[model samples]
Target: MRIPSYEDMLAAHERIKPHIRRTPVRTSDYLNDLAGCDLYFKCENFQEPGAFKVRGAANAVFGLDDEQARKGVATHSSGNHASCLSFAAMRRGIPCNVVMPRTAPQAKKDTVARYGGRITECDPSTSSREAAFAKVQAETGGDFVHPYNDPRVIAGQGTCSREFMEQTDGLDMVVAPIGGGGMISGTCLTLSTLAPETKVIAAEPEQADDAYRSFKAGHIIADDAPKTIADGLLVPLKELTWHFVSNHVSEIYTASEQEIIDAMKLSWKHLRIVIEPSCAVPLAVILKNPDAFAGKRVGVVITGGNVDLDKLPWMQT
Candidate 1:
């Protein structure tokens, strides 16, 4: 498989510009005081699909050729990617097939369907999801857009950082929540050229710390069914994503379940945004380790806000 390049990211920016939003960068005095740093929140949750995954999804769907478009695209995701790809395909008047875990939030499932995606439910395991997806892809003969592994997806994801650098000046570091590392990889891709001085850090849930483990071990380590409230980040990193994580990422940090929930609530209370648990990982890490980011101009990617209003993690009975 070919690796995505900086030029590809440039092209992806142009190709997906019309489809995805240049999500705003936000900040909070309270958050800055708490973290002892200037925190610039890239509000990807403001996306129409309520996630940054749409950046890559739109790039892949719209970049597809007529032949590929007719067959459409297929992917297996925990949540955000499925809905975003569905939204993009819908915009292009094409089909999207999603193989999602049955345990994924109902809000995500409903959003995918709302975007006209056909979902095939799978067991909540990397093994099971991939196993089921193989059948779906074979039957549909749709081009596969691996949720975070594809070069197109990574290149597409790189555009976010391009906009991030353009929107803000002199960012010392950028911290984004990592699942399969698409966002992190894209951040690496863009920052390597756009702002080489800026460090790219990854935040992950301790319960699902495969990426952290992989980073520390200098190799990829995957968990088939890791449990975490940050469902969007349950998947393990693939070769494409791992390449960037291993080479470009400066560090990987983890936060506990309660930390994630507390951070999620803090964003809702202060940032006044409805963000999912996955997006809270960055803030959780930043808050937990103030010394690392203190005095730095830190940029945090608020990855998504597609949480189920009825099932807030902190409100669990």
Candidate 2:
């Protein structure tokens, strides 16, 4: 499998600049005190589609030619990518069709519709998602934009770390939540080339820790439908992502569901930001293993903030 290079990432930044937001990098003294590290949060939650997924979606959508754009774009995502791709396609005045799990949050589904994308729901499993997406692609004749697996998407995601490194100086480490490993792959791509001295770490949900297991076992490990509060991290790693993870990542850490919730709440309370559970996994791992992060300048990628307000994980009885 081909991996995206620094040049691709630079091109992606230029390609997506007009379409996506260059989200802010925020810091909180309270959060720094709690973690014993100077934590810089790359707030992708502030993105137009409320997630960093827009970076990749925009690259894929805008890369297409006029004829290809007319047919539109298609993909399967838990939430953020679906909404992001829809938003990107809408910006270009093209059709966007997304295959999403039936169990995806209502707010996410609503966002897709609000962006004028058509949705097809499937069972909350990778196999089901792929099957449903195949039908969507066949019917719509749309360009396939694999959420985290496509080289274009990974290249687009690499732009985040490029921006982060530019926003903050002397970062000892960068951490991000690992789902299908697109964002992590992007981080790896950028940091490996631009900031080789800095280490790259991936955080995962203990309930759905295939990436963790894959990292340890030296191969890919996939789970069908592992349940977790960090719903965005449920997807397994693909070959394109595995290539970057196996080569560039320094470590993979796992955090429990409760830990993720605590971290999510902590970010909202202390940092005054609305981040999703998946976005909190990195902070949860940092909180769980403070010794590893203590006194270091760490950059944490906050992936998204697209959560259903009415059905918060902490509010459920």
Question: Clashing pairs in model 2?
Answer: none
Tens digits of per-residue lDDT for model 2, 96-122: 999999999999999999999899999
Evaluate model 1: give its lDDT. 0.94
* TM-score, one value per model: 0.99, 0.99
Runs in model 2 lying further than 4 Å from the true structure: none
Give the alpha-carbon lDDT of every model: 0.94, 0.95
Backbone clashes (count) for model 2: 0
lDDT (C-alpha) at residue 3 in model 2: 74
Q: Please give the RMSD of candidate 2 to the true structure.
A: 0.8
